[model samples]
Target: MADSESGGRPALARRLAAEAVGSMLLAALVVGSGIAAVQLSPDQVGLELVENAAATAAGLFAIILMVGPVSGAHFNPVVSLVDAAFGGLSWRDAAAYLPAQVAGCVAGAVLANLMFDRSAVSIASHHRASGAHLLAEVVATAGLILLIFALARSDRAERAPAAVGAYIGAAYWFTSSTSFANPAITVGRMFSDSFAGIAPASAPAFIAVQVVGGAVGYGLVRLFYPPTVAPGRLVSDPRRQADAPHPSRERSTLR
Candidate 1:
């Protein structure tokens, strides 16, 4: 059985809705918290980042738990692409998801700005372009993807929300670019001038490096968990009937 069939995949419209709404909420959390953090900790940059990271991590955990079932909660375009590449999602569905995620993120940024009494479409002035920044983006994105898929393959998908949230929180401090790790979020951040925003001039390089990181991460997944020669079989145990595949065989295949 296909993973979608066994797991009861929602309608495409429903899944798309979940993706959009989830992405919107995530962006709102990021931008709003950043704005609030800067205001609350005016002279303390470290305190501002701590507040922003805490809020973002908590928000991400909640959002993923809310929408993981519907659309795999892939607010990131590279994540959607990785799902498609690994056969957990179709290319057509991923294509639809990308635009929705991006649009929702953009809307969320605008909404956050409005809520904070700022212009809705102000391009960020915080320039974050540099070789070190681009390299940081690559490392951040690659680590994120690796962590997500690793948990998935290890039969720990249920732990993903917490793990992903924690990883992002840590990466925020460790990575030079504060781990934008997501192209949609990067673009959305371009519309805000708050603590979390990235300049328009910086978005492209960040996005490009993120994509490259995603590809490298996917390659690592393939390397570690090579495809099975037997397409639908979960195990090679002699006691188990080959004709009667495991219920989760298809889902496990992607792992």
Candidate 2:
């Protein structure tokens, strides 16, 4: 049977669909874990931290491995936006991806709340907007984007999927903001009063820092490794430019 969306089968569309669905489910897992952890044992600070970190790590790894090929596994909008800014993705794709991520994150939060038998969790209740916390958010989110783009630009994304997970897991423990690198995720997480939630009021501060950090990371990428235009207008290879396609060839072939 022909698919309704395209009036026939479409592999590219199907792949993108799968990526969106997979990313949503991954976000749900993170929210679910946070809600369950808080509901079951809200006061166990040490234990809850461990559980949350483990759960987030597992979900992140799954997302990267599952959708890495489909959509580059960009579950975070900031990462997608930054990549688009760098000319890695089209503005159209970025436009779609940003809203998809936000919706996925919100859905995850809602699902987590339902599972925990609560309408809302009071996460991020305290210690959200202080100087140190803001700084932590900046540094943590910056590191996350830096690691992702750096690996991708270096042609190592396929090899180091696990590093993304590890980086996030470690950031939770090391950074003061607990590594809320994703604005959408943070907003959704705030809906739940779980270990992962940040107060809704504090969302803007964290977001500001995260944006700054992402820009800094992008600037750094441009500085040490400048981009060049290939003869065919294709992106320049980070490792070498000599083998890039010639734009003239592309035009002649099309014509």
Candidate 3:
């Protein structure tokens, strides 16, 4: 996952571009689907959630499948950071990926806004920072990381697409914060004043908790399932087939 640029690996530019494009599409899926759900379901919050969750989940699966091979389709900064921490990816590569992901998410958010006939950069008005919500973020993020590594170690990387999509979809219901377990997505959500948006004021706490949750997840992963491969080889390894569930293919959905 380093910038080794060897062993049939893609060049660094391709990987970064893939991350950006993948992340951009992911944000669009999230914000766009939420907008559609609001329009389609109106004030029926429950139904709206159902619609939003369904679309995000299904789209996540497709996105991952379409882009996983090129860049592991991380689409989440925490995922990339954790991958690097364990040497599944190089620090250099992971650092570069962070900006690409963030930028892609921002672009995606703008795209969603424009697509929905809204301003290009309206800040979110929804604030979600209750104690319970924060706790949910921790649980949601930790579970996501653990799940990813668990599949990799179990030699079920191929099953990751479905598993990941299913888990995120389920998390949307179980987690109080609706499982915004990804930092890039959290940032993207801030740019939209819609069903899936989070107010900027609450973003800091959410991002902080996500990082903390990531640490907890990696801690647990290290505790129970130590690394089997050497450094620079892991779940996000360019050579490793991208694992993580794709939602709709399973008759499902994550984001």
Candidate 4:
């Protein structure tokens, strides 16, 4: 009853819609900001990065708040997959979220390019794959997964919006690849030849390490926040409230 009603097809449709739109907006913010950063801070690479990182961090926080209620605001494919693995989302729903997220990001890239008076679809020429960059992707993505699930499992999900935004902002400065921790965004960036763009050649390697990073994060979550050893019980245990969204409303956050 209640479970069926809450997670019924109609609800699924709404959630999918929310995921698509939220992801689109997220990509737009990231790519658009990168373009602005380059144009606004020409000849100052450091200043361009600062501007891009700041805008992305702030925009991510707001976007999560806007749609976290609807679809958990999982704008990233890795986040959606990991949430499914943790029993927060159904594998089926998680699977559906993949295409929506990727498509939304692709559309967003086009939108950003058009907004900047550029070609609608331009292949990025930026080649970012390097040994250190790959390693950094692993570190950045693993930390992201750990942060998100840590909040969910520890009943601190309410802080995810701000925390995720802050972490990504910091990562942009720390990670060599600017912490492109989201595969959907990584792909979305492939279509733009602007400041935020990643060459198509580099995307696969980045995405591969991101998956590895996701697995490592899963292990870390189990090690640090073991559900089997919960003193009271797992906060995100579906049996406790089957109809609840994986992280529930509070648990939902995006990067």
Model 1 stretches with alpha carbons more than 4 Å out: 1-7, 228-255
Alpha-carbon local distance difference test for all models: 0.81, 0.65, 0.82, 0.82
Return the top candidate by lDDT.
3
Clashes by residue pair, model 2: 121-193, 122-193, 123-193, 124-199, 231-247, 232-246, 232-247
TM-score to true structure, per model = 0.88, 0.79, 0.89, 0.88
The most accurate candidate by TM-score is 3
lDDT of 3 by residue, 43-136 (tens): 9999988988888888888888877767878888898989888766788989999999999999999999999999999999999999999999
The parts of candidate 2 lying over 4 Å away from their true place are 1-19, 39-42, 120-127, 228-255
Residue 99 CA displacement from its true place in model 4, Å: 0.3
Q: In angstroms, give how far residue 242 of model 1 lies from its true place.
A: 19
Task: For candidate 1, report its TM-score.
Answer: 0.88
Q: Which regions in candidate 3 have their CA more than 4 angstroms from the true location?
A: 1-4, 230-255
Q: Record all residue pairs in model 4 with backbone atoms less than 3 Å apart, i.e. clashing.
A: 88-246
Error of 2 at 135 (Å): 0.7
